[model samples]
Target: MLNAGGTPNISGFLVDAFGKHLVALPGSQRALPGGTAAQPAQVKFAPEGDELLVTEKGTQLIDTFSVGFTGYASPPTPHASSGVTPFGFSITTRGYAIVSEAGSGSVSSYDVEDGKHLNSISAATPLGQSAPCWLVTTGDGSFAYTANAGSGTISSLRIAADGTLSLLSATAGRLSAPLDMALSSRSKFLYVREGNGAVSGFRVMPDGTLEPLGSVTGVPPGAQGIAAR
Candidate 1:
């Protein structure tokens, strides 16, 4: 997310067919809101690919918009995030939005109707951890994980069929200032980016538990985000 002339904007990019070229599409930028304190911490497209959900920290809200065929966006529809300082989130196949609330150290879910309207399905459900800022969910949409930066821990939760969440483990794994996370293509492995110059790996168990796979050190310090393939 970029602050475009004091407004939060989502930029568009184009990649060449050969995957050797990339370019910014300036005209495709969609401005979320202007004249407000909106720090978009994370953005994810709905499973249908016709909508986008952005967690705004500064405004403590989640903004959703309908995406047009040409990549333009409809006016943003703001919704209470059901918690404070909403950060990373994932939209499930059933149109459920699961979000991590850093300020409240909890996770919440909502029903995103037709990519715009939002209704809370679950209030903030605490995991007894601190600063659970970044989140990732299973491909099956049955579980979710959050990296607790302040507590140096990872927490797991079972995402119910109705978009509710239940804490599975408060300390599923440990890291040093975990900031961002990604899951493997099969959602079998989970990786975390640590502020302490390392990325830790964990195996995803059948019951939503995490088994430590150790850490890869020597990553540049202050690395903020990560992706796994």
Candidate 2:
């Protein structure tokens, strides 16, 4: 397991089956430009490789870890965020990474191998979506989805051959403050958790659209996390 610390360091932990920690590895500090402390908000491993991608909310940057988790490498290129804040990201099976920009209400794609920014799709205003805090992609890397908390909706997108994002559909989620999401193993179902203590499920369509599967109510209020098997 990897833990993001307040000091902007990442610590690795080895745990046994019983969920007990067996060993704690030395923490590694992310070297951001200008030596700014990038408070790492989320981390995801490459879908087909050993690389790890981390989102730095404070500095609005993405950092990659070398294979075998040895060292940190700043992206070969720089991404001008224009004040957009990156929160969560997911790597695709096709060696691409998609990051959710909360400040800009958009999702940007990048080449994972070289950290090259490819294209970005706006999920706000004209698209009728806002504040996309979390993102998830299909196992085949054909589609991607964002949980738009600001507009209480979800936006569906299609991944082109060259790793560009094309908005497919943006529909009202009918949930309050949808924060986090997860997908079923076969990528047929999507489960979302709302800040208002509700869990909603959806059936992913062939065209990357979402069909409501109702929701479970009465969950303890302030529930903010979710996962799937």
Candidate 3:
């Protein structure tokens, strides 16, 4: 878990799924860039599972770390992001990194080598939306979607085999303040969490389009995360 209270440090814990318990390991807290304002938005494990990547919005950097056996992370090596306000991101099936830039309302792709070195694969590709705060990629990594909060829309993009990106639809779907997003385990359904305390579902079409599956309301206010299985 991240202690994201305007601090640059992150804490790691051990989880016991069957017991629904969390154990904070000593010496698991590690500092990132911008000591007091890293504003790290998201953390993802590399495809190899031995490295970690964090988006530092405050510093416009992507921090990479080597994970130790005890779940502790090494001192991070920071790389400048391809765009501004890097927020949500994911690793592609080909081990490339796709990131969403909230400030620019665009997305960028990177070649992550050894889970630590990041080489820009493609420059920022504008989705022509606003505040794309969350991103999700299809299971095959051929398609990706971003929830544009400011524009109340979802944008789609195509990911090439070499990690290059191209805009698909800047307004794939329109909703109210879409924030976080998740894909079903089978990658057949997409779920978007709205700022209005509601969760909406969509059927991912064969051509990388979205078909509304309606929504469910009554979620607690301020909820910001969703998972699908």
Candidate 4:
């Protein structure tokens, strides 16, 4: 966990399942020489279980941490400048990291082990979808879905075996601001949290399409995060 809002010296924490404090690691003083402070927005372990990827929202960079958090590497401008604001990311079973770029309204893929840029699919390329803030991948790692906040839609992309990405489809999402998303354990369903404090559920079709199952009401306000067990 990153102390994103901390001042002077940002830090990372090693937490346990029960939310117990385990270890605290210090963050780099600066993301780049004489650059802005580092503010980590999201952290995810690589699918291969050997590396960690952290999104520095403040510095617009991705920080890779070695296994056991023993080493660190900051890739200078991993994603395109258009997609600099990396907000949410998901690792594919094949060890590819898919990151949602809110600034550029695109989704980018990277090699989890070496921090190499793989490919990027724009939500605005053929479709007018924009501001994809969050993403979730199918259990099989064959497909990915991003919640487009600006266009209020869901953009689907097909993930090739070699970690390449291609736009598949964009469908209307029944929400104002789709912020976060999660896939069911078996990848049978997808749940999205909207800005209106409602959770919308969709059935994940075999062809990587979404079938709306309506929304769940009565959720608390400002509910922006969700996960499927």
Q: Pick the candidate with the highest TM-score.
A: 3
TM-score of every candidate relative to the true structure: 0.92, 0.81, 0.94, 0.79
| 1 versus 3: better TM-score goes to | 3
Report the lDDT of model 4 for residue 76.
31
Model 3: per-residue Cα lDDT over 1-229, one tens digit each: 5567756677788888799799888888888876777888998887677778889888899988888777888888899988899999999868888999999888999988765689998888999998998999999999999999999999999999999999989999989889899999889999999999999999999889999989999989877699998
Itemize residue pairs with steric clashes in candidate 2: none
lDDT of 4 by residue, 2-77 (tens): 4455341223445565868576556533232113476556777677655666675666666665544443434333
After superposition on all C-alphas, the RMSD of every candidate to the true structure, in Å, is 2.0, 3.8, 1.7, 3.9
| Candidate 2: worst-modelled 10 consecutive residues by lDDT | 118-127
Predicted model with the maximum lDDT: 3
List residue ranges in candidate 1 displaced over 4 A.
1-5, 14-26, 34-36
lDDT, model 3: 0.89
Q: Which of the two candidates, 1 or 4, achieves a greater TM-score against the reference?
A: 1
Q: List residue ranges in candidate 3 displaced over 4 A.
A: 16-20
Q: Which portions of model 4 miss their true places by more than 4 Å?
A: 7-39, 69-82, 114-127
| Residue-wise C-alpha lDDT for candidate 1, range 41-123, written one tens digit per residue | 87778987788888888888788888777666677788877888998899888888999999999999998887679989889
Model 1 residue 19 CA deviation in Å: 7.5
For every model in order, what is the number of clashing pairs? 0, 0, 0, 0
